[model samples]
Target chain A: MSERVSRTTFYKRLSRLWRNGDSRPLLMQALVVLVVLLLVVWVINNTMNNLEHRGISTGFDFLSQEAGFGIIQTLVEYDESHSYGRTFTVGVLNTLLVSSLGIAFATVLGFLVGIARLSANWLLARAASVFIETFRNIPLLLQIFFWYFAVLAALPHPRRSLAFGDMIFLNLRGLYLPQPVIEQGLMPVLASVVVAIVTALVVRATIRQHRLRTGQGTIAMPWLLLGVLVGMPALVWHFSGATLSVELPQLRGFNFRGGITIIPELGALLLALTIYTAAFIAEVVRAGIESVPKGQKEAAAALGLKPGKVMTLVVIPQAMKVIIPPLTNQYLNLAKNSSLATAIGYPDLVSVFAGTTLNQTGQAVEVIAMTMAVYLTISLSVSLLMNIYNRRVALIER
Target chain B: MSDQMIPARKPPKQSVGLLVWSKNNLFASLPSTVATVLIVYGLYLLLPPVVQWGLLDATWWGSDGTACTTEGACWAFVTARLDQFIYGFYPQDHQWRANVFFFQLVLLIGWLTIKATPGKKWVLGYALLLMPLVSWWLLYGGLGLKIVATHQWGGLMLTLLLALCGMVASLPFGILLALGRRSNMPVIRALSTAYIEMWRGVPLITVLFMASVMLPLFVPEQVVFDKLLRALIGIVMFQAAYMAEVVRGGLQAIPKGQFEAFGSLGLSYWQGMVLIILPQAMKLVIPGVVNTFIALFKDTSLVLVIGLFDLLAIVQAGLNDPAWLGFAVEGYLFAGFVFWAFCYGMSKYSQRLEQQLHQGR
Candidate 1:
């Protein structure tokens, strides 16, 4: 009897613990933790053993060593003498430069083409659809190759460069444009414009309060605001002796000099990235626009708003609410895809730090970790910002 | 309304005429008319020269670049290297093995895709299990067949192999990760989320770099994987994260009632998942899975970074050949067309599947 009672109690306790929500979940979680810990430990052990056997020292100190590499194009001051750390900075800035440019161009083109897809004109809509289908279906890497090796490489040599109105030049090497060199005096003029903007904002806030106190005063004094915005900047510029001059690219040696030089690699990468990403963005934009019910547009028009205003004030705002979440994804993809620059030797972060540095130092672990970390930080921050915007948009609907 | 539903009479001939249709569609307004004219003018200026260069003035039936005597495209390079582009460096004598492998794939894929075909279970089993073994035995070769190293594989064959293998290997992993992500256990969910986000945050280039560079270091010295296998592993790891998110979307849509019903039937978690939950979730996510497959197909081109000569890489290499030098335009056009055709076909099929699934729902 005693044995039976003890067995029953033990079984009862075990079954109760298993059936309970809290204990079972906790036990499952603990088991998962244990398994993961074991796997991580095993991996670490193997890694340590392998590293030791291969005789590859791992540390971030390699960053301070000289890179001894010549990046063809850099957004920052970079040379063979620069440290690996400086190469990293240059790589990051170049990546950002291309990504931002690609984003701006893709957005503008995508919106135009996306809106065109819905045009009443049959030919225009078909053209837009054809573009989206063609670019979207092909891989971006192949497009990059087509642009670089096929199209750009086929351009005439620098001696017979195609010149546009004596300010822009295109050749096998790159596209060159006259850069604006601002004089030292331009600083005060820029400062004065900033002051004028602040003054205008202050004036508007005071006017809003004034209107609240007295019904006679209107809140928007367009004339006064316009004068503050434009006249102040103009007057300051006239007095500040600010001079801006164009620095035209001149044929020097084998290449252009003294102007903004877009290396062929960057150009091809930008063109391919913009065209490829724009196709997807266009689809997203079209879907967002289509998601806006026709009844809403009809209602807006019924209120006597013009078609343009209906789009700007009513339809676009609603469409944006749907467009942005997907737009964030596209932006993230573009940023990540920018790493493909390595294939074309565009000196991106991966090419410079992860490729050159890792090869020179043979520090695969440190270099790859840092590269992955930079991307992780970028992706996380971008997604975080977009999420906040998404929340605000969602909140506005209520 | 007539009781017999008076046969919908054909509208007046004037209304149905092409002139009226064109008026509404192409010239509905001044801007529309202008747009029509502008597009027509643009096409007029562009189409003829493109057509001439690509077709009329192009050289064909040539063995080398020198045979091209025209001022237009020299398609001779593509013609001469067509076998290389299709089969890579696979030995010419045994090229029929590759053909046989492709035929098997066609039959198996046809069985799944034709809709009227039966034995979905058997087909899936053969594809997921037996197909890989057969492909390896045939392509890599052993067991009474001469051994062919993976390095010899290149061209469109490699591209398709990488994509198919990546999709097949990553699918089960993606499902597991999705399940882990939606698990009630915090550790599992957190780990799944971290794994997915880590992979998603980086580019495939970096992942390939890791696979080619660091993966060997993580394993024992004697356990070295082949270069192609390493690249495939990287691809699977990268693609599985995307697949997980797609599957998770399907899992999230599954109602709580299904869970409760499965539990009430005295089913365990795995049993419920395999029988009740996964079947519906997988059906719901078939379109998404296909989209991922399309993406993977395009991404296989990136294996060039790791020194694998996929179709794009093969074309790129062909560009540098002294005999075929300066024919970059023809080389790229052929490769681009092939990629475009495959991707477009898959995307269209995916759209049709999505619509059919939606209609069923």
Candidate 2:
């Protein structure tokens, strides 16, 4: 009888523990935490053992060592004597250069094609659809290869280069355009431009306040702002003795000299990234514009608004809410896809820092970790900025 | 009034039929007419040369570079090296194994597509469980079959295998991660979130590099990773994060009432998810899964950067051949066409599936 009473009491205690408020969940969570910690510990321990056995000491100190390889393209000052750390910065800047240019060109082209797809003209709409489908469906790598090897490489030599008057030249080497040489006085001109911008902003704000108070729209303020922005820069350039000159490319020996040279690698990467991404962006833009209700367009038209005004006032603003999120995603994708430059020897982050540096130093862990961190930082920053903009544009309900 | 009405009899010949349609569509405004003219002129300048190069003046059959006598595309190179392009360095005799594997895949797809297939759940479960093993046997060779190394594997075969295995392996892990992310347990949520974000934040190339170069250093000294296996691991990890996001989107779409209903039935957490929630969630996410698969298919091309002989890599190899040095254009175009066809077809199918599934909602 005593044994049975003890068993019953034990069971009662067990049941009480199970029924305790939130303790079961807490226990389960703790168990999960324990398992995760153990797994991480195991992996790290194994890695350490492996590294020790392989005689590869893992640390980030190698970043300060000299990198002895030449990069084809460098956005900042870099050479073979520079440390790996500087090479990393150079790689990152090159990546940024390609991504930013690609984004700008892709956006402009994408918007044009997107609007064309909705054209009343049947041929224009069909052409836009064909363009989107043709470029997007092909693998971007193949497109890059085509641009690099088939099209650009097949260009004539510098002596017989294709030229547009005296301004631009294209050949097997690259596209050469006149380089703008800004003289010393250009600094003051640039400063005046900044001042004009600030003044214009203040003037615009005051005009907005005046219009809000008096119920009269100040239309001339926009022209005044534009005038200040353009006129100020021109006047300063003229009076401040800023001498701006264009140095045209001259064929020298085997290559062009004096002008800005766009290497074939950059041209191929830029063109492929722009054309490929533009197709997807076009689709996003089309979907955004279509998502706006037909009733809204009709309502705007009924309000005596011109077709262009209706598009600007009613369609675009509403469509942007749907467009911006996907647009940001496309931008991120283009940035990531720029890493494909390694395949074509574009000296991107992965190619220069991760590929060549890792190979030379045999410090795979440190090189890869740093490269991944750079990308992660970029991705997160882009997301945070876009999210803030998205929130601002999002419709709020009372 | 009758006389005025009698005058309105017949419309002009140009104001009817195709002419009228063209007038409304192509010549409605000055801008439209100008755009039409420019587009037509552009096509006029572009289409014939492409057609002549691709079809008319192209060499249809030859064995060497010398066979391409004309200025048109050297399709002869693609034809001559077609076997290498398709199978990479796989032994010609063992190419039959790849064919059999493809056939099995087709059969499985056919069975899945047929609406009236009986015992579908059991068949699908069995196939899902057994297909990987069967494929491994067919690919790597075992049990009286000649042993074929992964390095010998390349071309479309390797691309398909990598994508299929990655998609299959990632799906369950993605589901678990997605569940953990939404779980009440804080530790599990944090772990899942970190894993997803870390993988998603980095480019697949970096992940590939880590797997190819660093994975060896992570494992025990005696253990070695095959190049294909390393690339596969990277691909699976990268894809799982994307898959988890898609699955999470599906999970968030499910109503909270379903969870409560499962709770009222005295179901455990796993039981509720498995029986009540996941089925609806998975159904809603079929399109997303297919889209991810398409992306994975395209990404398999990146294996070339890691020195894997995928389809793109094989084509590149062919381009490097001394005999076919200048025929890169044709080889790349052929490979591009193949990839485009597959990706485009799957995307279209996904759209159809999405539309069908959407109607049920």
* Top-lDDT candidate index: 1
Could you tell me every candidate's TM-score relative to the true structure?
Answer: 0.93, 0.95
Model 2, runs deviating above 4 Å: A1-21, A218-221, A395-398, B1-16, B114-123
Candidate 2 residue B135 Cα shift, in angstroms, is: 1.2
Off by over 4 Å in 1: A1-21, A196-231, B1-14
lDDT measured at residue B351 in model 1 versus the true structure, 0 to 100? 93
After TM-score superposition, the amount by which residue A185's alpha carbon in candidate 1 deviates from its true location, in angstroms, is 1.4
Per-candidate Cα lDDT values, in order, are 0.91, 0.89
| Candidate 2: chain B TM-score against the reference chain B | 0.93
Judged by whole-model lDDT over C-alpha atoms, candidate 1 comes out at 0.91
Q: What is the DockQ of candidate 2?
A: 0.73
Docking class of 1: medium
Residue A67 local lDDT, model 2? 89
B1-361, model 2: which lDDT tens digit per residue?
Answer: 4655455757678777998999999999999999999999999999999999999989978878888899788898888887887788899999999999888887887786677877777767756577878898998998989999999998888888998899988998999999989987788899899899889888898899999998887767678889999999999999999999999999999999999999999998889999999999998998899899988898899999889998988998888888777887888799999998988887887898899997987
